[model samples]
Target: MKVVLASASPARLSVLRAAGLDPAVEVADLDEEALLDGATGATPAAKVTMLASAKATTIARRIADTVPEAIVIGCDSMLHIDGELVGKPGTPEQAAERWKAMAGGRGELVTGHAVLRTADGGIDRAVEGHAVTGVRFAEPDPAELGAYIATGEPLVVAGAFTLDGLGGWFVEGIDGDPSNVIGISLPLTRKLLAAVGVRVTDLWESD
Candidate 1:
């Protein structure tokens, strides 16, 4: 099956490529504010699942003509601290503040992924369940937090931290999939792909 990625995240793209999956990109600017609204009541898994589904479905509608018969994957992630959803920080100050809060604390980074089949006039599709991973961060001094934020790595990350960047220093360890923190979970991606009868290797046999 042809592969389509319904996300504009560079990290997610890098993860997919590294996994040997070469998928076409069709981005959708999901209404994240609306999506997060009233989400406090949901478990972390449910929240991520909802956001992932919304993103995948939105792109599926947009790319129906361009990639019919292809399976589109949509993914979303969030940082859950004490049952609160934390998203990407839009500003440097916000990034610093979020880091302060997450420092020395363990949290869950839930990644939700969906696979939508655009075949048969977009009538058939399958969405994978939400994937959850646990991460721990050692407490950092204010100076370190400021310095990491200045590097601009935390601003674009879902949990206000990037395990592959300067933020990596703060990571104590992870209890589950590390790729989930980066943006996509490889094991979960493999499972989703195989469930749809396509493996990651199939996408990169030539490349």
Candidate 2:
């Protein structure tokens, strides 16, 4: 089966490539903020999963006619702290504020994975799930925080931080799968694929 990644995140793309999967990229154009805002009272895990499913289904329906046997994968992530959900900080000030709030604190990085299998221009199988990782942040000095924020890395990433980028220095520890913290979880993706009757190895590129 052909594999398609329904997201534009470079980190997510890099994760799949590192796992030896050469998935075709097709970014889903959807209003993420609107979706999140509309989902009232949903838990962080449920909200992410819902968004993931929407992305996968959107892409799968769009390309099913051309790639009937394709497996479309979609993913979304959020940081849950003190019963609140956080996404991308969107601005330098917001990023700096988020870092200040997160310093010396712990939160759960939740990533949702969804897979949609299409056949003969129609949906065949679908599966969605989420993986949670406990992350602890280090209390960096104000100068260090400002310097990191000036890099502009945190503004575009969920939780206003990254484990595989410049923000790594501020991360004290992590529990559970690290890939999930990067936006996609390989192990969780494998399980979701299996749940939809496709093996993870089947998505690997030909040697």
Give the alpha carbon lDDT tens digit for every residue of 1-207 in model 2: 788999989999899898988789998899998998899999899999999999999999999999859899999999998788999999999988888789999999999889999999988999999999999999989899889888889999999999999999999999999999999999999998899898877666451
**What lDDT score goes with residue 28 in model 1?**
83
Error of 2 at 82 (Å): 1.8
**How well does candidate 2 score on lDDT at residue 123?**
83
Whole-model Cα lDDT of every candidate shown, in order: 0.82, 0.92
Model 2 residue 179 lDDT score: 98
What lDDT does candidate 1 reach at residue 178? Answer: 85
Q: How well does candidate 2 match the true structure in TM-score terms?
A: 0.97
TM accuracy, model 1: 0.92
Cα lDDT of model 1 by residue, 43-97, tens digit: 7788888888888888777767765578788898889887678889989988877
